[model samples]
Structure formats: C-alpha cells, structure tokens
Target: MRAPIKTTLLFSMLSLCMSCSNTTALNKGKEKLKARFEVAGICSNYTFSLIEGMADTSLVAASWTNPQSDSTYTNAFGVKNPCDLPEGLKVGDEFYFEIDSNRPNRCMVCMAYYPTPAKKLNIKVLEIVKE
Candidate 1:
C-alpha cells in the first residue's frame, strides 16, 4: 500500500511538470509571433494617437490617453489598459501616435498574453511630422 501511494504521488508530480512545460512552450511560440513598434523625434508638449487592429473585438483595448486632451498617445494589443503591458506586442494590431518631438523621446506599443499579462514593444520614431 505504501509503495502504491508513492508511485501515485510521483506520477502526479510528473504530470504537473509536463503540463507546466507545455504551457511554457506555447508561451514561447506566442512571443515569437509578437509585434513591436517604435517612433522617434517627438517635440515636447504635443500629443499622438495610437491605433491597434480590431479583429476579435472581444479582446480588451488598452491605451493611455492624454488627460488634458481626447487623444490616445500609447496603446497595447490584447490588454484592456495601457498600463497593463508586460513585454512585447502581438501582430496585426496598429498603433498611431501624435508626439511632441521638440526633444527626442522613445515610444512603444505591444500585445498582451496570459501569465505575462502584456507585452509592450518599443517604437523608434525617425522623424515627427506636422500635418
């Protein structure tokens, strides 16, 4: 009886380990396909808009909107809030920004996944144009 109990415990541990490994592998694959964006040359005191694709509208849209204005400056895919990004971004989502580039600064956007929560990617802006 003791031997049987030990064997069952060992099997259960092994199964748990296997399940964890599978989840890790899946996350890695998802990360590999994640998206990244960057923008540079933003002048100070200006605003920008970030847009992400809308495929599964069910997924929450996360963004950081300027408090004084009605424009969204930063955004992340698969996240309900801009502050929830974990790392890099997922593919297919688009981000638009209107930055104040009087001084050089960096902006980023990305996608979110479970366990990690969200993946934020850095966006490098080569130039900031006025329209």
Candidate 2:
C-alpha cells in the first residue's frame, strides 16, 4: 500500500520535472532581438532600420540582416502602459526582447498608423540593451 503511494508520487514528480525542462528548452533556443522605442503622434511606434541583425549574425555562416523588418510591430499600450512592459519606457530606449506567446495581454489600447508594421506583438523584454 505505502509502496504504491510512493510510486505514484515519484511518477508525478517526474512528470512535473519533464514539463519544466521542456519550457526551459524553448527559452534556451530563442535569440533575443534588439529594438528602440520610438515616440510618435498620440500613439507611439517602433523604428527598426536595416542597421543590422544581431549577436552571431556577423558570422559568415548566418545571414546578416535585421531579425525583424523596420518597425515590424508595436506594443499594446493601455490607459496606463503596455500589459507586460515596465513603466517609464521612453523614446529612443533600446532593449532586447522576444515574442512571448504565453504572456497575456488584457490591456486596452488605441489603434493608429505608424512607419512600420503598426501591429501589436506581445513581447518579453530580456534586458535594456541601450537608450
């Protein structure tokens, strides 16, 4: 009886560990992209020039080009701020980020046209690369 219970507990723990590892595997392979926050009219937007790709792009083996086109997208800014982004993010602030599908976006934001894609993409900011 006790042995069966222990076996069940061990199996459950193993399953949990496997799930955690799978999530880590995803984060491990993803490469962060850099972009600068640009202020526009009533709605702010992003500006990404052909300036270049990133990290290992310089290597001859990899195609050197910007990961995303110029201003591929923007964040969903609500009455306060983007759902996941931190406050005080201003124009010309550069940061590294990745698309985070798991991150929920329940914030309400306005729609507007911009230089780039002008679309909203939920992202996880890896770090502030520059400003």
Candidate 3:
C-alpha cells in the first residue's frame, strides 16, 4: 500500500513540474515577441478629422498611406490621450505614426480595444514635401 501511494505521488509531482516548465517557456516566448515589437515604428502621412467620423468621440479615427509602398491603411483609431488634442487634427496632415507592432490588427496610437502589452502609443508629425 505504501509503495503504490508513493508511486502515485511521484507521478503527480512530475506532471506538475512538466506543466510549470511549459508555462515558463510560453511566458518567455511572449516576452521575446514583445521585445521584438517594441523597437519598430512606422512612418506615414496620416489623414485625420476634428469631428468624429467612423469612430465615436471616445475614439480617434485616422488613415495613412505608405509613401514608399503606396499601401493604404484606413480608419485607424488613436488611443485616448491623457491630454486631449482639443484643437483636433486637420483632414490631411502627415505624421510619424507610432504603431503597436505587437497588436497587428490596428494602428498603435489609435487602436480599438484589443490585446496590448500595457504599452503606450506614440504618434508624431512628419514634415514632407508634397508631390
């Protein structure tokens, strides 16, 4: 009886250890991905509006087209600012749009509620000559 009980206990401990190691490995992978995303930023000409359009007042709706690739990204929402841009944005203005690489679905600064790593978004204006 004692031998059987010890065997069961040992098996349970080994299983628990395996699960813990797997969890640790998963956490490490997530951390690596987060770090990879942190260093990347995208630059484009952002088009915004002072009045709410597709996005509600709680959201900041904007769009941008990549100059090099001519790739158009539309209806991107900016994250809620601690200090609001009350002056608002012009309909067509270029900016150094900060992007959340980790959350690939939406723009970094103007994002719809999604999986984020508790990181703040950074959006900056970019000065470029018009063609």
| Backbone clashes under 3 angstroms, per model | 35, 0, 5
Residue pairs with backbone overlap in model 3: 77-110, 78-109, 78-110, 79-109, 79-110
Ranked candidates, highest TM-score first:
2, 3, 1
lDDT of 3 at 60: 34
lDDT of 1: 0.35
**Weakest 10 consecutive residues, lDDT, candidate 2?**
57-66
| Candidate whose TM-score is highest | 2
Q: For model 2, what is the alpha-carbon lDDT of residue 124? A: 71
Local distance difference test values of all predictions, in order: 0.35, 0.51, 0.36
Candidate 3, superposed: residue stretches over 4 Å from native? 32-131
Q: Please, what are the lDDT tens digits per residue for candidate 2 over residues 1-131?
A: 99999999999999999999998988754656665664333444443221123433222122222234333333222112254665655666777766565667667656774433323455676776642
Q: Estimate each model's TM-score.
A: 0.27, 0.45, 0.27
**Best candidate per lDDT, number?**
2
Error of 3 at 90 (Å): 19
Model 1, 1-78: lDDT tens per residue?
999999999999999999999888655423212223322112212222334333222222255443333444343332
Off by over 4 Å in 2: 1-25, 43-81, 111-119
